[model samples]
Target: MRYFLPSKRLGFLLLALLLCGFALNFFMQAASLNMDAMSVFSWIGEYYWLYLAGGLFFFFLLLVFSMILPSVYAGSAVAAVLCIVLGIVDYKKLSTTGEPLFPWDLMLLKNAGEMSHITKGMIPPLALAAAVLLIAAVVWLLFKLPKIKVSLPLRMLFAALSVAMITGFVSMVAHQSSLAVSMKYQNIFWNQKVNYKQNGLLFAFAGNLRQSLIEEPEGYSRRAIEEIAAKYSKLPDPVPNVQATQQPNILFMMDEAFFDPTRLPGLSFSEDPLKFIHEEESATPSGFLLSPEFGGNTANIEFEALTGMSMYFLNDGSIPYQQKIVKMSSLPSIVSILKERGYRALALHPYDETFYNRNRVYPILGFDAFTSEKDLDNAGRITPEGYISDKAAVQEALRELKASSDPAFLHLVTMQNHFPFTKGHNGPNTISVEGTSPSYKDELETYTQNTKLTDEALAYLQQELLTLDRPTIAVFWGDHLPALSAGIYTDAGWDSEPRLKHETKLVMLANFNIGKEPLNTLSPAFLGPTVFRLSGQPMPPYYKLLGKVQDEMPGLSKQVLIGSNGALTAFTPEQQQLLDDYRMVEYDLLEGENYSQDLLF
Candidate 1:
């Protein structure tokens, strides 16, 4: 029943505690997330007011608790402990996934049991021990601190002022402030690493909190979607002659962290890791694929490829698999179109079925069956590097193709080459790097060796399909580049431009002779329509429009959209109109009342 009030001495000590808490939070977050200390410090200095407001808010909460607590130090100590715990969790999350912690991640706590694999190895034993010691020291200090008394009326007034100040600070950070405008740029839509690296984790999280809410697309309504769908309905339908009685078995494989490292300038490997790919590209339909993500966010590329929707239109760092696809029959995807054409669509991934909620998402995408890591193992398949090996994944795809007499569409997502390509891991180290630092060289070598294994698997799959009597086509591409050590490109004298960083290899190989025609560069959004074209399958009205756009645009992402001249340009009026129509249709399907379902499906 003792009441303690804030004094000048206590206020100064509390302010000092708040500053110390923030410092610890920043340092821990930076170290755990592999961020540059200097850059984080600079960001903090530039946005000091935001942090000051945040500090005062926390300090005010402590003051309210100090009214009932033994002393102000007790409340301060409690707040410090909570911040330390938060820092540890954030550090662990960033270490496992290159993605920094976002506000949306808090919703994922419900699935913590499923995320044990990802959350493991986040806190080292030494770090855990240190945190424990720090918490204990703070608690011991709290007991020795002195307490002050204040009148009840003054305490009530102080608490009200604290609440007002907190509200003012939050409002400033959210809107109508100069710092808010600058913070918006910190969010580089396609590349979240830059956002976190430049703005610091706290600001990045705050920015994403606003982005997490799904906003209605401009001009999005039931009537608008119907009108857009009707306008694009006149586009040419699939050519009748190309639609064979028996559709070819379609296999689309997204190799994890797979890219051609030989693209780096002045870089020579001990041997060509992608020798098979190079040989096949010469005789097959091949081109560079521009991905919307780098380092991670594999699911976003998969979403674009299957749904024929552009991530550029969505919020920055949005995970459509987790956020958009909530119902099984909502989103119309390529899988649904193929199923309508009597093709049995099967999805395969050699990892936990629950990662990114794939177990739930695949069915929503219209896959008849999803064979995940557990399913593969139940059937007696082996996994390499704690993942389903590419070789094993290909073998499963072939099995699925043969399982049903009906023409099949196999969507295989491989995970043998997931990131953290540390030194002396998963390798005979067949490839060597010349220009990069020793650490980068080691990581690159590991990545190259795994990719080589992936190439061998592709070659095996191609040969196996060739032996089969049924005509089949295989589309192979990388989801994104690996999360290699920083400065790898700068060290190799390669272009550090965003476009170059986002490039990955794409190849379309068919068993029957389709003639060796080269393809233009493509984004993942265009890949679905391109597959329908290559397979000679009839597509929906929206797809027909998308095909036309692909013919002109070829490749488009938030970072760069290919012009008719084959150069990056701001979308021309015509191009913008096409994109606007596309966006309207996408909104209709994903967020609006699904007005275009019958037309698209």
Candidate 2:
């Protein structure tokens, strides 16, 4: 059947859209492939169908937007620049933090100074130049060329067709329709890094777009929340509150990317890199913390620690700061809990206030004050590479503590030991370990030196706390393991012994002797309750419930569920009940109605 013909032939416009579509796709994938032209070309050759999938989606988007202006070259040019820029930004993000760009990450753009900061990392000069010159020249040349005129009616028709086709394509990906199934597109929801590599970036992004629809726990209702709340309400206080003459000053100093380098499998240094930490751990209550996040997403670990909530139940690849907490009216956290008893809660981080929306979010979390990079007097007290050192963060916390008379819940987050681990960033590298990997020697040395400095800073904080006449308690821990540019962790057995990648030490030091003992490993969610119990603070029903769960499920997460025997084991029926109750309560607080916020928290 012949459709209605256009008044005049629309020549070369369709071809232009097709060429621009695939070209834009190549540049975008180049970033994810680490600007390796060889790898990008090889991937195109191997995953020909997947390449076409992303390209076709881009083509439809360009077609629809271009039709709005009804100019062929002009529309494609706008689309091309946006796509190329996205590629550059994604490249920088992956290289710097080991995290890829997601669809919802667009919300992070609201934070000022983010764009300039993201564009600053270790981007290769040739790749950046070639991407700019080649694509820019092509786009500029296209813009200068003669316009292929199509009537408004024909443009509208084309736009409608493009919308329908792309909508169908997206629907297929989201719903896993038969056609998409036939194409064998694996979403890889469990591992986002692999998802982007395996399914192509666009397909993986579309997969995440559907994650806004949160799943409800089985038989979720107000009744379920109340039932859980009732159980905790009847339960006895895990540790009764003491009639302390004075409330102790509590400091949670979370060091950036700090870990025991001596513990790494398949490699070692000449001596212990964290000598100070080792000595302190033997004297205090210290053990490993099973950090939910690995290389980056420090905010998530902070969320779990500050709030007695598990990231295990939340959506995969989701950042609570960006996705959940920022939107909520008030989140029940350690800060809020401590503030009820006249404790002054303050947050300290030597990075941008807007890095994780902490500037606005901290107030919502009930922080009395937040001191960030801009707020500091010596904000530039940093390494040569400009990452604010751990020393500066600890000093700021000490100053805040000294100034306040009320028991302060100071949440100190360090920014040293962050990426681009250039050799001698801190000072001379001491090979404290016995061996080394051939691939990541320079980075390993730089990272080792950084850890030594972190240990020293932490020791310094503890020594200062001891001098204070007032009773004081402090907990220091690592947020996550440092990620190297070589990306050799998986090869070096991070995957085989998954705990090694997630494992980080947790130490609790106090001026008063509260019977310190070593902990094998525990989840960040349990840290607040542990501190409360140790410090003789009044325990709320919600915290009491968490304490109970931790007794059974220590260091538990979606991936790592440790058994009583210290090995990964299947869930028992009793364990299943505990898990379900935990999920229901978390859902009630986070996503569902706050039915029992008062009753529980």
Clashes of each: 0, 9
- Residues 1-601 of candidate 1 have per-residue lDDT tens digits of 3344556875676567567656654664464346567755665677665455445556665566554454656655665566555555665545544466666556566667745643333346797798779878877776676655566765666667766765665566544367556444345544566766655555555556545323566877777777776777777765532455567998999999899988877767889999899999988889888898877778889998998988877866688777668544557888888888898999999877877778888888889999987776543223333456788899989988978798899999998787556544454676776766665677778788888888998999988998766788899999987766547766655444767778899998878765566776789988877777766776678887788778778778876677656776676788788878887777677777778888666
Instruction: Tell me the deviation in Å of residue 298 in model 2.
Output: 1.1
Model 2 vs. true fold: TM? 0.86
Question: Which model scores highest in lDDT?
Answer: 2
Quick one: best TM-score, which candidate?
A: 2
Backbone clashes counted, model 2: 9
Q: Can you write out model 2's per-residue Cα lDDT over 263-294, one digit (the tens) per residue?
A: 76677676677888888888778899999977
TM-score of each: 0.81, 0.86
Each model's lDDT? 0.72, 0.78
Model 1: lDDT of residue 327: 44
Candidate 2 global CA lDDT score: 0.78
Quote model 1's TM-score. Answer: 0.81
